[model samples]
Target: MAKSPIVFAMANPNPEIRPEQCDGLAAVMATGRSDYPNQINNVLAFPGIFRGALDAHATDITEGMKLAAAIAIAESVSDADLKPEFVVPSVFDRTIVERVAPAVAAAAIKDGVIRKR
Candidate 1:
């Protein structure tokens, strides 16, 4: 345990370990609070997933589609810009929906879960 550990104290409003409390101890620290650097907010997900399903005229929300949405979100951040403090984009990043929608829609199409009609 020499290297810094990854910690996710994702609790509503109050995380188990606030970022400042852990400070340099954790390599990557995330919480449910928006004020923190790496906030694991659900807002960053659902909307785009729904939009993509609708756009693709999907009949069901498949696991493939969910994975696609997650990948899209992670891909939103460039490797060069990636850091412990900025693992994910903000909920209001605007491009999240833009990127996620297409990716999810594509996944639906690939999964053959689209509307038959």
Candidate 2:
């Protein structure tokens, strides 16, 4: 049986598969818990997203804005720094807000949903 290349067992307080269990089976793994290396926590994005919406005076968060936020988060991790075990940045990384806010705000403005630019 071939193991999965990626596994995002992002259960809340407990994940479906603990990180240790995925040692050689998965190339990448993520969980909702911060104890693991790659934690797929909303805390990494939401604050910046709200900040961007407020900054741009966006009436609503459109798909484009969401995509921009995702892109910003992805870009936050440089290609050279990107690793299978470190797909997403640490939630503690302060750069998330700096990167995501501008990207989301720009997307809102481009999408014509921003009132204040």
Candidate 3:
């Protein structure tokens, strides 16, 4: 499946679903934190991503840049860093965000996804 914002919204408790959704909806929600172990969210992704793009002096974001942001965020927490209710870093973990964003921005530059950087 394609990775995008839809992944996050699908995990919502009351996903704003219309008729004819799909078969994979349950699978998606099953992998969510409310139901599964390593629950992920855009909140877990975006702040650091945009921060990174800005830090790199980039004019825009890109797919490679977003992938970099996600990986960067995941790397901040080790297996040793995980716990129930703490599998992902807290949103208030400014250090994690601050550190992660620049890495993502660097990825954007390295991927040549940003122009006039």
The candidate maximizing lDDT is 1
Per-residue CA lDDT of candidate 2, range 25-110, in tens?
Answer: 88898899878888899998898899999999999998998999899998899889999878999999999999999899999999
Clashing pairs in 2: none
Pick the winner on TM-score between candidates 1 and 3. 1
Clashing pairs in 3: 52-101
Instruction: Tell me how far the alpha carbon of residue 34 in candidate 3 is from the true structure, in angstroms, after superposition.
Output: 7.8
Model 1: how far residue 81 lies from native, Å: 1.2
lDDT of 3 by residue, 1-117 (tens): 453223333535654542125344433322333443445556767778877877777777787888877777767777886544354565556777776788888887887767672
Worst ten in a row by lDDT for model 2: 1-10
Name the regions of candidate 1 deviating beyond 4 angstroms.
none
Provide the RMSD of all predictions against the true structure, rounded to 1 decimal: 1.4, 1.7, 7.2
Task: Please give the CA lDDT of all the candidate structures.
Answer: 0.92, 0.89, 0.62
Candidate 2 structure lDDT: 0.89
Give lDDT: candidate 1, residue 26: 90
Quality of model 1 by C-alpha lDDT: 0.92
lDDT per residue for candidate 1 within 1-110, as digits (tens), equals 34799999988878877888788789999999978888888899899999999999999999999999999999999999899999989998999999999999999999
Badly placed stretches (over 4 Å) of model 2 are: 1-4
